[model samples]
Target: MKVVLQRVKSAEVQVDDVSVGQIAQGYLLLVGIQDADTVAEIDYLVRKIVNLRVFEDSSRKMNLNIKDVSGAILSVSQFTLYAQTKKGNRPNFMHAGKPEYAKEMYNLFNDKLREAGLLVECGIFGADMQVNLINDGPVTIIFDTDSNY
Candidate 1:
C-alpha cells in the first residue's frame, strides 16, 4: 500500500466529463496498491493520514489533524505511484497490483477512512479521472508499506 497525501483547500474528480467525487477541505489521497498490500497496511495509512498534523493551528503552527479542522477526504486510485522506470524511457507497471486486486484494496481503504468518521469521497477504481485541487500550504506527504523515506 502507498499513498500520496496532500492537504487541500478543495478537490474534485471527474470521469468522462462528469463529476464523480469532490471534497471541500481535506486531504487529497492518491492511493496505490501492490500485490503485497493487505488490510494491515490500509489500517496503518488511514490512521496516519487522519491524525497527521498538517493543518495549522491559531498560532500558525502545524498542529491540527484533519478531524480537528473538520476536513473531508478525496481518495483516488493511482497505480502510477508504483511505476518502475529503471531500464529505459518506458515505464513498467509490474510493481503495481492487478486491477482486480487493486480495486478491492482501494475500496477497503476508503471504507476504513469512512468508518473512522471522516467524510470520504472517491474516484472510480478503474476509470480515467481528472482531478483538480487547491493544495493548502502545498503540503504533501507520501507513505509506503515497503520502504521508509
Candidate 2:
C-alpha cells in the first residue's frame, strides 16, 4: 500500500466530463495497492494520514492536523505507483496488484479513512479520471508500507 498526499485548497475529479468526487480544503490522495497489502497496512496509513500535522497554526507553524481544520479527503486509485521502470525504456506494471484485488484494497482504504472521522470523496476505482486541484503550500507527502521513509 502507498499513497501520495497533497494538501489542497480544493480538489475535484471528473470522469467522462462528469464530476465524480470533489473536496474543499483538504488532502488529495493518489492511492496504490500491492498484491500483498492487507488490512494492517491500511489501518496504519489511515491513522498516519488523519494525524499528519501539515496545516499551519496561528504561530505560522505546521501544527494542525486535517481534523483540526475540518478538512476532507479525495482519494484516487493509481496503480502506476507500483510501475517498475528499472529495466528497458518501457515501464512494467508487474508489481501492480491484479485489478479485482486492488479494487478491494482501494475500497478498504477509503472506508478506513471515513472511519477515522474525516469526510472522504473518491474517484471511480477503475475509471479514467481527470483531477483538478489548488495545491496548498504545495505540501506533498508520501506514505508507503514497503519503505521506512
Candidate 3:
C-alpha cells in the first residue's frame, strides 16, 4: 500500500464529466495497492492519515490532525503511484496490484477510513477520473506501508 496525501482547501473528482465526489476542506489522498497489501496495511495507513498533524493550529504550527480540523478526505485510486521507473525507459507496473485485486483493497480502505469517523469521499475505482484541487499550503506527503520513504 502507498498513499500520496495532500492537504487541500477543496477538491473534486469527476468521472465521464459527472462529478462523483467532492470535499470542501480536507486531504486529497491518492492511494495505491500492491499484491502484498493486506487488511493490516489498510488499518495502519488510515490511522496515520487521519491523525497526521499536517494541519496548522492556533499557534500557526502544523499541529492539528484532520479529525481535529473536522476535515474530509477525497480518496482516489491511483495505481500510477506504484509505477516503477528505476530501470528502463518505459515505466513498469509490475509492483501495482492487478485491477481486480486493487479495486477490492481500495474499497476496503475507504470503508476503514469511514469507520474511523472521518468524512471520506472517494473516486470511482477503475474509472477514468479527473481531479481538481486547491492545495492548502501545498503540503504533500508520500507514505508507504513498507516505510520506503
Candidate 4:
C-alpha cells in the first residue's frame, strides 16, 4: 500500500463532470493498493495518518494532527503510483493490484479511516475523475506500508 498525503485547505473530485466527493480544510490522499496489501497495512497506515502532526500550531510549528484541527479527508484511489517507467517510454502497471482486488482494498482503507472517527470523502474506485485542491502550507507527506516514513 502507498499513499500520497497532501494537506489541503480544500479538495474535491469529479466524475463525468459531476462532483462526486469534496472536502474543506483536510488532506487529499492518493491511495494505491497492491495484491499483497492486507489489514495490517491498512491499520498501520490509518494509525499514522490520523496521528501524524504536520499542521501548524500556535507556536507556528508543525505540531498539530488533522484531528486536532477538525480536518476532513478526501481519498482517491490511484493505482498509477506503482507505475514502472524504467524500461521505455511507456509505463508498466504490473505492480498495481488487479482491479477487483485493488477496489476491495481501496474500499477497506476508506472504511477504516471512517471507523477512526474521521469524516472521509472518496472518489469512485475505478472512474476517470478530476481532482482539485488548494494545498495548505503546500505540506505533503507520502506513506508506503513496506517502508518507513
Clashes of 2: 0
Q: Estimate every model's Cα lDDT from 0 to 1.
A: 0.94, 0.95, 0.93, 0.95
Per-residue lDDT of 39 in model 2:
94
* TM-score quality measure for candidate 4: 0.98
True-structure lDDT of candidate 4: 0.95
- Among residues 3 or more apart in sequence or in different chains, the pairs in candidate 4 whose N, CA or C atoms overlap within 3 Å are none
Per-residue lDDT over 1-149 for candidate 3, one digit per residue giving the tens place of the 0 to 100 score: 99999999999999999999999888999999998899999988988997899989899999999999899999999999888898989988899999999999999999999999989999999889999999999999998988866
The alpha-carbon lDDT assigned to residue 44 of candidate 4 equals 92
Q: Tell me the spans in candidate 4 whose CA falls farther than 4 Å from its real position.
A: none
What's the TM-score of each model vs. the native? 0.98, 0.98, 0.96, 0.98
Candidate 2 lowest-lDDT run of ten: 82-91
2 or 3, greater by lDDT: 2
Query: Where does candidate 2 stray beyond 4 Å?
Result: none
- Candidate 1 local lDDT, residue 128: 93
**Global lDDT of model 2:** 0.95
Q: Tens digit of lDDT per residue, candidate 2, span 1-149?
A: 88999999999999999999999999999999989998999999999999999999999899999999999999999999998988898989888899999999999889889989999999999899999999999999999999989
lDDT of 1 by residue, 1-149 (tens): 88999999999999999999999999999999998898888999888988899899999999999999999999999999999998999999999999999999999999999999999999999899999999998899989889876
User: Per-residue lDDT for 40 in model 1?
Assistant: 89
Question: Where does candidate 3 have its weakest 10-residue lDDT segment?
Answer: 140-149
